[model samples]
Target: MTRATVQRWAAFSDDPGGGNPAGVVLGADDLDETGMQRIAADVGYAETAFVMGSGRERGIRYFSPVAEVPFCGHATVASAIALAGELGDGPFAFDTPVGRVDIETRTDAGVRTAAFTSVEPWIEELPDATLGALLALIGLGPGDLDPRHPPRLAFAGNRHPLLVLADLGAFDSLTFDPGEARTLMDAEGWPATIIVLHEHGAGRWEARNIFPVGVIAEDPATGAAAAATGGYLRAIGAVTPPARVLIEQGRHVGRPGLLTVDIPESGGITVSGTAVPIG
Candidate 1:
């Protein structure tokens, strides 16, 4: 069996210590599912991206330390930047498990950024019982919820429960049971993370992604969650169409990251961020 080389990247931030770290394997056409999972686990990142082809169109798979996910935005961004370094910056089409994703890569001011258009997004109301359970799991009460934005299950590529808090202090003091949260997420088929948001201004939000991927209790940055947030805001009429939203995340974890989301009147949401090689 051939061993595939893995590249490490920090997504959503230019600094190596900032954004979420991801493992990218280029030319992984020979690797099997077990091999990919082993590599992901060994890399110890939230997710790892495996590319099966080396053309304008490619087959991509995302795997966490424990299991394979339908899609992973941070890994995709990391993989795109890695590919751009070798193949030159341009557009690449990915055939993910959820559906087709088109990612565009560009260089501005000597910084490379990749933007991926998510699959058609939608939102569903979170059940009353589920909402209560979620609140309890996070040590947050019903009163802490923002009245303006109701709890809902948002989906871009993966499902995430969107819970908007009324105060930023809640985020500063946020905590959750990783074991319980993982069980709930697995049972609910939410392969990504639980997104907690606090709107600081119009089209701007501070987000915390609760992701228990192996030993990692939280995700410093989650592009999928950011995309889902955009869809949730649009579906709930919280934001107008043709809007650009900013998501600030990873601060609580000490790895500050930023995500730019572009919401059109319809169709997929575009999530953009820059990734830098991690030393």
Candidate 2:
């Protein structure tokens, strides 16, 4: 197989060293699933996005080192920014495994930002047994959960278990066994665990994403989880409609990425972030 050109970008942060690093492969129509998986493993990022076709009919796929995921938010943002750099800033539509995703890219001065509207999101109550197992894996008790936001499984393109903590101290001191996390995530079919802490001001949150199933112990910035979180907040009536929320992630791990989530009265959640090329 011919080697594909892979572009690396740090999503949700303008700095190359900050945020999540995602590999973007354009013109991957010729690559098979096994080939894409191999390239993703070689790239060694949490996820790699493969874009095929063109224009409004573009097809995209996301692959982790271990497996192929239905959708990946950071990779989607990275791919959109990478494409914008090549094709000029504009809107792009992608046909993903979950559904259609629309991404808009804009360049102001030298900064490039990409925002993608996710598929219609939904939330489901997390089963007691599953919640107990997850808490055990993370070494947290039910008491550790924040009463403000109840636990629930939220889904945009992929599913994530949302856990809100009461204090910043708990959010900053997160630790979990990778083996146990992966086991529980696989059994529950969860892509990651989205742990969040509400900040002092309105529409502000601190987040940490644990992604053991993807062979990533923690993700500096996770777009999918952010989208799911917005959906969860709306579903639980924690936040009113037509609100914009800011998510601060990767601080504990030191990457420090910023994600903006826009929640409308209904329909898809929009997650926006800046992506810069990583040398």
Candidate 3:
């Protein structure tokens, strides 16, 4: 079997050390699912993106260390930047498992950034039993929940349970059992991550994504969760139309990443970030 060339990139930050790392395998037409899984496991990132075809449009698939995921945000950003490096910065469309995601790449001052529009987003109420179990797993109680934003399951490309924390201290001091969370998440069909957020200021939020199945306990920057947050805000009427929200994440993990989320009056949410090569 021909070895697939893998490119390592850190997404959501121009600084390689500050963003979430992802593996991008361009020209992966020869690699099957088993090969992709093996490569993803070897790369050891939260997720890796495999691309087939060429030019502005390509077929993309995402895989975690253990299994294939429906969609992934940071990996998509990394893949877009990877393509831009070879094909020149411009618009690119990906035919993902969820749907078509359109991305635009621009280079300014020698730093390339990418912005992607997520699929149609929606929200649903989190069942009480599941909420209690999740809270226990994450070491949080119902009292710690922020009343401003109710608990909900937000969907952009993947399903993420959204929990807003009332106290910034509690949000920052979060600790959880990764093994337990992995079982729960897998059982509930939540292969992505659970998003715990704190609204520190108006239009500014601090997020923590509890990703149990991966090697890391928490993801520094989560594009899918950020997009889901935009949907949660819209579904609950937390923000006015044409609002811009800023999400600061990964500080707890020591690799901080800033994700820019744009919420329009209706339709898909747009997430923008910069990626850099990782050694």
| Model 1 vs. true fold: TM | 0.98
Compared with the true structure, the alpha-carbon lDDT of candidate 2 equals 0.88
Task: Tell me the tens digit of each residue's lDDT in model 2 across 1-279.
Answer: 567999999999989999999999999989999999999999999999999997645999999888898999999999998888778898998999999999999988878899999999999998999888877777778898889789988999899988887777766776888887787888877754555555546778988888764457888999999999989989999888999999999987789999999999999999999998899
Better of 1 and 2 by TM-score: 1
Cα RMSD for predicted model 3 = 0.9
RMSD of 1: 0.8
lDDT of candidate 3 over 44-69, digit per residue (tens): 99999999998899999999898999
lDDT of 3: 0.93
193-212 per-residue lDDT for model 1 (tens digits): 99999999976899999999
**CA shift at 205, candidate 2, in angstroms?**
0.3
Error of 2 at 169 (Å): 1.1
Error of 1 at 185 (Å): 1.4
Q: What lDDT score is found at residue 117 in candidate 3?
A: 95
lDDT of 3 at 230: 95
